[model samples]
Target: MNSKIYFDGSIMTAELIGEIDHHSAKNARMEIDALIQQKKPAELRLDFSGISFMDSSGIGLIMGRYRMMLLYGGVLRVVNVPHDLERIMILSGLGALDIFERQGEVYECT
Candidate 1:
């Protein structure tokens, strides 16, 4: 897996690439968590624009980050989710999360 992270004031955005299955969850989690801890950003925007696949571990990853941000009095958002993963997230009840449409798109999860 590969990731690019950027911080704009209190908002931190992470653009993740590749599969987000069991094989990559740990490393991905560690990488993002480290940055979150260091920055303590008020908002985390996870950009899945480059992701090709994601399994249950992906849900876990999002849930964990949501909890972390909640604890910090912050919030988390997922963006640019592919169709397949969007189905998975819906089935997994992850649609309750704050998910936006593709990059620069106006649609968003309520």
Candidate 2:
């Protein structure tokens, strides 16, 4: 997977692309964690709009980031998740966390 991070005030948005799996989660985690540690933003938004595929590793990725953000008293928001992946995430109990958010035309998990 590949990602691009943007900063808007105290909110840092990470746009994840491609596939998220065992092979890519580590690098993505490292990159995102580095920035989170360096900037300590008030919010971390994980944009999954560009993602095409994901596995259990994706769940781990999100959970890990959520924990990291909590350590710094930051909120973690997952947005723009595709329909298929959204179901998977919800089934994994991520939806229950109330972290999924709406972004413009993107559907918000309820």
Candidate 3:
């Protein structure tokens, strides 16, 4: 997996590329969590514009981030989600809690 993270003021954008399965989710989780703690960004933009694949572990990662941001009184958003993954999120009932950002085309895990 390849990731590029940038912070604009308090909004951090973590752009993810490649698969987000059990193989990489652990590392991804650590990296993202560390950044979240360090920056404590009021808003986190998870840019999935490049993610090609993801498994159930990816769901856990997302949920964990959501909980963290909730504790911080912040928000986590997913951007440019792949159609397949979007369906998985919807079917998994993840969409009900996450707000899909239509303007930028992403999901907000609030």
Candidate 4:
């Protein structure tokens, strides 16, 4: 999998591409975590629109990032999740995490 990260003010957006599985999860997590630490953004927006497949490792990835963001008093938001992936997220209890359908909008955490 590939990822592109950009910042919108204090929000760090990671646009993920390709498939997310055990093979790619570690590297992807490291890359995204480094960027997040560098930016120290108030939110981490994970855009999964370009992802065609994702397995359980994907769930771990999101959860890891979610916890990391919380350490900085930030939040994680998942965007543009596909139907199939959404099921996996739900089954994995990732649905309990903050998720959204739109990209590029600003989110303020209270």
Candidate 5:
């Protein structure tokens, strides 16, 4: 998997691409974590639009980033989730975390 990271003031967005499996998750984690540790942004957004495939590791990635963001007193948002991947994320209990902000549906974070 590959990720393109963007920074806009206090918000950092990581646009994830390709397959997110156990092998690729580590690299993705490290890349994002490095930036988080350096920038300590107020918000982090994970963009899933370019993702072609994903497994449980993808969920782990999101959960891990969520925790890291919380530690930094920042908010995490999962955006542009494909329909199929959205189902997987919801089934994995990610839907309950208040991290998703789909195109047509909005999830309130509280």
Candidate 6:
């Protein structure tokens, strides 16, 4: 997995690239968790435009981040999910959350 995290004050944006599978889930989660703890963002955006594949591990990653952010009263936004992952998100009933298609941008929150 390829990833980078950018933070502007309390707003953190994580960009995920390449395949999101068991192979990279551990490292990815560590890095993202580190960033989240360091930044303590009021809002976190997980950008998935560059993610080509997402398996069950990816689902776990999403849920983990969601719970982490919720603990701090933070908001999580998933953005640019491709067709297949979008289908999964929809089927999993995660579309009710703040997953963005084309309208993802920097957002500030309390």
List TM-scores for all candidates, in order.
Answer: 0.89, 0.92, 0.88, 0.88, 0.93, 0.85
- Clashes (N, CA, C under 3 Å) per candidate: 0, 0, 0, 0, 0, 0
lDDT digits (tens) for residues 33-107 of candidate 5: 999999999999999999999999999999999999999999999998887786678678877787889774785
Q: Which is the better candidate, 4 or 5, if ranked by TM-score?
A: 5
**Tens digit per residue, CA lDDT, model 4, 1-110:** 99998888998889999999999998999999888888889989899999999999998998899899999889888887776676777778655554544546532221
Better TM-score candidate (1, 6): 1
Off by over 4 Å in 5: 107-110
Winner by TM-score? 5
**Model 5 TM-score?**
0.93
Over the stretch 19-102, how does candidate 1's per-residue lDDT look in tens digits? 999889899899999998888999999998789999899989999999999988888888888876777777677666645556
Cα lDDT tens digits, model 6, 1-110, are 98988888888988999998888988989998887887678998888889998887887888899999998889888877776676666656565565454455532111
Candidate lDDT (C-alpha), each: 0.85, 0.91, 0.80, 0.83, 0.91, 0.79
Candidate 2 per-residue C-alpha lDDT over 5-110 given as tens digits, one digit per residue, 9 for 90 to 100? 9999999999999999999999999999999999999999999999999998999999999999999999999888887797778668776677887665434444
Residue pairs in steric clash, candidate 3? none
User: How well does model 6 score by local distance difference test?
Assistant: 0.79
Tell me how candidate 5 scores on lDDT. 0.91
| Model 3 clashing-pair count | 0
Decreasing lDDT order of the candidates: 5, 2, 1, 4, 3, 6
